[model samples]
Target chain A: MESQNIKKKSVRKAGLLSLIPGLGQMYNGQQLKGFAFLAVTIAFLIELVTIGIPAFQDFVTLGTVPIRDHSLFLLVKGTLQIIITFVFLMVLILNVSDARQVAKQYNTLGYVNRSARSMLKNIWENGFPYLLTIPAYFVMLFVIVFPVLVTLLMAFTNYDFYHIPPAKLIDWVGLQNFVNMFFLSAYRSTFVSVLGWTIIWTLLATTGQITLGILTAVITNQKFIIGKKFFRIIFLLPWAIPAFVTIMSFSNMFNDSIGAINQQVLGLLNYIPFVHVSDIPWKTDPFWTKTALIMIQTWLGFPYIFVMVTGVLQSIPDDLYEAANIDGANAIQKFTKITLPMILFATAPVFITQYTFNFNNFSIIYLFNSGGPGDVGGGAGSTDILISWIYKLTTGTSPQYALASAVTIVISIIVIGVSLLTFKKTHAFSNEEMM
Target chain B: MRGILSSTKFNRFFSRFLTYLFLIVLSIIIIYPLLITVQSAFNASDLTAFTLDLHMHWTLANFQQLFTQTLYLTWFKNTMIIAVSTMIIQVIIVTLAGYTYSRYRFKGRKNGLIFFLVIQMVPTMAALTAYFVLGLIINGLDQYWFLTMVYVGGGIPMNTWLMKGYFDTIPRDLDESARIDGAGHLRILWQINLPLAMPMIAVQALWAFMGPFGDYLLSAFLLRSPENMTVAVGLQQFIADPTNQRVAMFAAGSFLISIPIVILFFLLQRNFQSGLTAGGTKG
Candidate 1:
């Protein structure tokens, strides 16, 4: 009798393990896990039986529906579902555990009869890394992955206000939402217009911010500049403060009636003959509303550019500048030849991201005007971006869930397309030394 | 003589004067809004107008009313709870993921890294609708953990990138030496890697702490019930509550809210700047 027990399962057993959820564990000689998996299956089956009966009765009869909130019942069902889900997860984990143990035993001991103590020890030692990853996996799955999947599913269904709950069944709608967005009468024009405005807004705001930011950084970084530190800190405040506060503060400043920008800053400054006054209409007017958004965005955005440029500026070898200077390069020539190219190359990815970010910049636009002056006739505000429009569709009084889902898919496609193009072209991602 | 006249002393004097002038101008730009906010917060008026003259007539009435009349405390408590929980969860997860990505040469390491990078590029709006539906599902489950999970989820990718980059900069010899000393991966991470990554951890903590503090969209959407309202969402009620257009209260609230962030900014600015600047454009 060999000391190392070389026990093996039949092919049929292996096939059975593949068929059943936890049979793999039992085959690997973890009976407890297999039994636990069976128990959870039974429990969830019971729960489904319990909830399905009445829910089915109400749905099929359609004459005399249950006259209860069923909140408690739903709660119980939800809890059971969660528990079942958890147990299913546990079974999965145990299967993996058993497989790993079996593999390790085969490798190290050449047998299936490794002591439980040794098994436990191996798990304790090598398993911590795997165990440590559980939270990350759980968070990503439940939080990001689950929701995204659910929303993707919802996009395929009629989960609008009319189809809230028990009263109505949310049958699949296919690509009707997308169809509605593109060609349908209700939203086609509004969607196209809002999307156009969004693109324009993103372009203007991002460009303005980057332009101002580079200008400020250039000016401040100059040897001749005074109070460089002070200017730097001042410029950085927008980045420091929560964006909500900055936008809110500026919105108030740009308010039509009592806004300080109008009443004080501009009111005082615009009195001068050279300055074009005529009451800038920061909020109400279409052109000025967009302008206000751009200005505030510029103010908020420039700081990041400043910081990035500053870093790039510091890293730029002084020899390049010295060489350029020696070659009789004027300040403009030197900046054009050396500074501009260097910073652009270093920050091209960030520059592209800024555009995409502004494209989806919901917070500022929403807070600034709630995408308002409402698109009563045109369907969205002069300042309304695609993101805000989506927000309106989702949270609007009518609650256009299907439409919102369509918008989401559209935005995702656009973002994915743009990012892929950039990634492929610049290989900006190749430099992302992830870890 | 001319060269001597243009010496270090003269240059220093000239620079000093310009510095002072620039500082004064920039300080005004930075400090003016803050002053206005503070003044507006203290003003006792029907309309919280930003009038210098009116602002001069400061009063504690706005703060008094905020404490006395509104759900400000509840909002504060909610915001703090959310922020703190988010910070803790973020630090733990980011710390783990970051270290793993930084040190471990696992099979899916490159794939995972690129996945996170692309995911990071996916703007909040793209995923937001999905998140809202997620919230509803979780809310259906009747758990606060669901919303917390979302915050933690959104934060992990960015913070992981940040912390991972920071971790990569830490010398690998420490991990190697720890392994030689009979410490396991977790033990080494806990005992050695984490301590070295503290500054980056602090940066992660700050951003996570501020996340729930300033967020409005998710909180507003997810936390439908008034009792669960964060300060950011609660503050919005002031504007939407047409009867109570006490814009001063919003300003007062804004003023109060800005404190922790300001302190955080000043305290963590060094780590924040260094962490972002150095790790952001890794080649």
Candidate 2:
């Protein structure tokens, strides 16, 4: 009873001492670990008080003085400091937990606390995964989280054209940008129009490519077709070229006056007696620009879909089609009932990504026409999607950083919502079952 | 009339003809711009820049000019540095994380994965301004290593998912049996599991390597120096100005750079398909 009481006291004592960083480990007879942790914790605490608290203070105020204190700098510094504090707290919790675990083992299992050298030697096998993943997570804290946090915070601030840094200070403006973006007539209309086109572009381009890909795959898969390799190689040729290069090439070739599409492409198309060709305004008009974009996207993207669908088609049993034929199914019926469902089942997740991909497709729009044939309105071009518009806002001579960030948040919500739904519906997001 | 009454044979022939015709049309549509690009690359005609100058004086002069007169070679070197480094870093980190995620079930595993998923959905481009600001803070705007690390960081979430998914499909039995034989985790991974997972790793490596080549917006925004531009950014500069656009040189440079990549792309076509469906979006 006396020995049990002493053991119980030791466990509780270990837990209590952990509040001072490394004291618990020392109590548990882990001298090396205890000293290392104690030293590091003490050093961290010193810095936390000296730099961390002041950084948070500046983060809240942005800066008490203008010009002298760059708010952007203060904002960035404060964010980093906050991340550091969070990390420190996490480490502290882990250290406390470790101390308790060791103490419990001693009390319950009569475990011996191993020598520091032995423990250190065994650490690799014991903490292999954690050690390896630490660098990745550490980099992510700054690279992903820091930037994302800054952008999110910037949305609530006044960091636009008028509030150019160094000369004038930026301040937190709490939904002012959101209000102006949505409630204000000018910005609201632009948003609606751009968003409408964006939706249309995503739908039309993605669907067009998928449909074309499926159809081509169906045709190519027909055993009656000859030179299957040749046809497939030709079909997938465009995919070999990078998207930006292809888009840029199309941009030059679709030029209003001297572009090859107006002369060579159409002239060749008109070779068939049934087809007639005329000069289409690929650049000047909004309607044609949208049309051309969809076509170009279809042309650029179909190869990927074609490749995927073909792979799916090859694995699909010939007996399914043979069975359909025995059932007196016509071509359309066989396709609708068998081929379509099989392909969709196999390829739906990727297809959903295509929809989202086209939704935010920044490069194609920007590279194609510079989101071109500038809108009659003062801001965004007629062809500018939300992403390209955001690019325009943050870049160029006069940047609207705060407004762009607000738009970014809006885009984030929509994209994340779609992605979440997709992830939830498909097990693609999780490896729990497989693992 | 009697011979013509054999409609089935005629139907087969006619269907074959229609299929060929349709394929030919698509083939032509695919090939037209490529042909024009080729033509412009070789055409030494000052009379017409982007037109279908059918009577082309085929010259390798444009290719020569692309190397000598411009920063094409420099941009290629810069891009390769970023791409290769990003690829190496991503592979190391991704493989490590992937192996752990598949084998281990420690605290925050599920949360970590979910965080990766959610974070990737947060558009990399959405944080462009912040990244630019970060560069300013760290003074890494021109630093290739910085850019490479940023690429690795941005890619980790989705690439980890891809890697983990692929690795999970690798049986735990290999690991168990290896451990039974007294092999450590690293040795088991090196000897047994890694070889099996090579195809997936290769796919991941290729995707990671290809990223720096395709990106324009981020590279353009972050890189301020003239010599620091990646191929994506530098190539665009050629045709940025309409009056002074080096259309021929642009064509030549694009053509030159594309050959090897395109060949590599087709060669690994099968591998990439697996990677594509593994839920990665470079956008």
| Model 2 pairs whose backbones collide | none
Off by over 4 Å in 2: A1-17, A268-276, A317-330, A376-378, A426-435, B1-15, B47-53, B274-283
lDDT of 1 by residue, B146-251 (tens): 6677789877766677677778788999889889989886688888988888877887888888887767777877777777788888887776554656778888
Candidate 2 per-residue C-alpha lDDT over A150-198 given as tens digits, one digit per residue, 9 for 90 to 100: 9999999999888877778888999998998898888888888888888
lDDT against the true structure, per candidate, is: 0.71, 0.82
Candidate 1 per-residue lDDT over residues A41-112, each given as its tens digit: 666567667864554443333223333432223422343354456666666656555555554554455555
For each candidate in turn, the TM-score is: 0.83, 0.92
How many residue pairs clash per model?
0, 0
Task: After superposing candidate 1 on the true structure, give the runs of residues whose Cα lies further than 4 Å from its correct spot.
Answer: A1-113, A124-128, A223-226, A376-379, A432-435, B1-31, B44-48, B121-145, B241-244
- Model 1: how far is B194 from its true place, Å? 1.4
Model 2: how far is A39 from its true place, Å? 3.2
Candidate 2 local lDDT, B1-283, one digit each (tens): 7677778689778888988888888998888778778778888875234666767799999989888998999999998899999999999898888777777887777788778778877777768889988998888888897788789998898788778767766778878988998998789879987898787788788778878887888888888788998888998988888888888888888887788777877677767655554433211
